[model samples]
Target: MQQEKESAEEINELWSLYGENRSMEIRNRLVEHYLPLVNIIAGRLAMSLPSHVDRDDLIISGYFGLMDAVDRYDIKRGNKFETYAGIRISGAMKDELRSRDWISVSLRQKIRRYESAVVELEGRLGRSATDEELAERLEMSIEQVHHLERQINAATVIPLGEYMKSEAAIAVDTDPHRSAEYIETRETLAKALDELTEKEKLVVSLYYYDELTMKEISLIMHLSEARICQLHTKAMFKLRGFLANIDGI
Candidate 1:
């Protein structure tokens, strides 16, 4: 605890120094102090990405984010620098991935069709549709549906920074008036989560909330990694549809 307090004090001193002079020396020190944050976010993101995506490239992109955060951070905002910097770092990496357009146009179309089918079938059935039901509704074999679900899962394994922007996209204010919207969104998310099956819910919780790798989750759940991925994909689609219905997202 003492060590942590001392580290925080040092960082605050550096921040103060940089705020006063805006010198490269002080800024570089601040950057060095927070580089570990970039590594952590980059590492988590890399776990979800394909092996071909170079981890070093992600780290390099995230360095730019860290620099931007250092430049723009407001000490008076009452937000922790680490929290703000994590978002910026992860956002930078995601922007790099988006520029690459790793997921093909055809795959994107397939994902849209799959999401639409899921929404339609669930609405008509008045419940979460099973894999067989989804296959029947989409006029595809169960194997094909599973394959598409895997693809969707892979494509959707974006950093939490991007996930927050894409999924929430609402002002998170502390004032009662503005906060009401944020509260409602949280409630909607909770309700959508409740709609998921026990296994699907566990998968979502483990992957997102617990920050466990898919392999870790697979071992814990005693299921194949591929099966866990499918569950995550299904849960994400359901939550997206539910939120879309409520927020027109």
Candidate 2:
């Protein structure tokens, strides 16, 4: 199947015909056209997950997501359908990952404690806490800290794209935050992003913004997939910790 995104005119023509007739064939074609996107998103997400987790299963879940996007998309929304569909696709794959969660409840608690230690130490140290510092704060060995990082990597289901979309959706739900808190939320997000090292930030941008796979990012940064995942997990840790402290996030 061709994975390339179709030109706007061609897509618009198909959409226009679909709009005129509401034909099943036209809708199927639209779904066919975007199948590569489903593969792209599912593949990228699977790279961050464990090896045993089925990539095909993620792609299966993504098919439904793509169909949902095709059905629910509004032509008048003025946003690119590909962008909207990618978010929906990623969100669906994440939901599937959540359903298949293997992390124990106690381990989740330990993760919380780990995050607390990182935040607490960072607050005291006035910078990103080193692995040594984190180990001391959590009363664990350096090796144990590395183990925790691995665990966090496996348990980290929400990538930056999914997090950003979910947070923005919550922001629009009845305007929970006033203008000032909303502004603060933006600033808080900016500050959280700034917490990452330059390499980590580039990984975030390359993966979420550019929608490149881990392999692509590794090639770009000259790092192994494991190392890239490590960077991603740590960046996410800092972002989640900081955002969790925000009022309406």
Candidate 3:
């Protein structure tokens, strides 16, 4: 425990120095200190790689994200570097999955339909259905049903990075002069949300706006919990893309 604390402190120090664009020594320290975090996230991602991907490749991708996080983490935020960096690193791996076409549109639509079906079934039955029951209702094999259900494990993770970074972006200032800026930011975000795909929008609504658990969401939508998870994950990846390109919001 003491060693872990010391290591985390070292990571924070490196992050601070890097954020200020300090010497190569600080950058090197940051990489060395956080390499373990990259590896940990990479290991977890490896479990989901469709049995054909190279784990070493995924680790390299995660390492890049960890390095980026170490260099870019803001000191003003109260959140720990480890907490933020972990999400970024994990998100990087997920991006790689998208590049591999693991989360295609057809699969997303299937999950959406499955969710609707489950919700309708439970509405009539008034209880959670078994895998066999769900399979029968969906006209799918039990194994197929299980696979579809597991697919929901992929979720759209909301990138809180932008929201955390620009305090003035969303915060309302008492100064009347700044009201124009607030209105512009809201418009920018609205435009970005408008550009999202249907599944992405639903994922955002169900998970963020509605604050539904993936399981409860699955029940409500009439889909397996795993499918809901996947939709949310995929949606988050797209939202991150929008956030990266949009300037103000």
Top TM-score prediction, candidate number: 1
**lDDT agreement with native, every candidate:** 0.79, 0.78, 0.62
State which candidate, 1 or 3, has the greater lDDT.
1
Q: Candidate 2, which ten residues in sequence have the lowest lDDT sum? A: 165-174
Please give the TM-score that candidate 1 achieves against the real structure: 0.81
Q: Stretches of candidate 3 above 4 Å error?
A: 1-16, 19-21, 103-113, 123-127, 141-144, 147-249
List clash counts for every candidate, in order. Answer: 0, 0, 17
Pairs clashing within candidate 2: none
Encode model 1's per-residue lDDT on 79-153: one tens digit a residue. Answer: 677767777788789889888888888988998899888888878998778889989988999999888887788
- What's the residue-level lDDT of 28 in candidate 3? 65
Greater-lDDT candidate between 1 and 2? 1
lDDT of 2 by residue, 83-164 (tens): 7788778878878878887567988898889878877887888877777888888999988888778778777777456555
TM-score of each: 0.81, 0.78, 0.53
Q: What lDDT tens digits, residue by residue, belong to model 3 across residues 162-234?
A: 3432334233234555665556555656666775566557766776555556677788778876766555544
User: What TM-score does model 3 achieve against the real structure?
Assistant: 0.53
lDDT of 3 at 163: 44
For each candidate, C-alpha RMSD in Å? 4.4, 4.2, 9.4
Model 1 lDDT vs. the true structure? 0.79
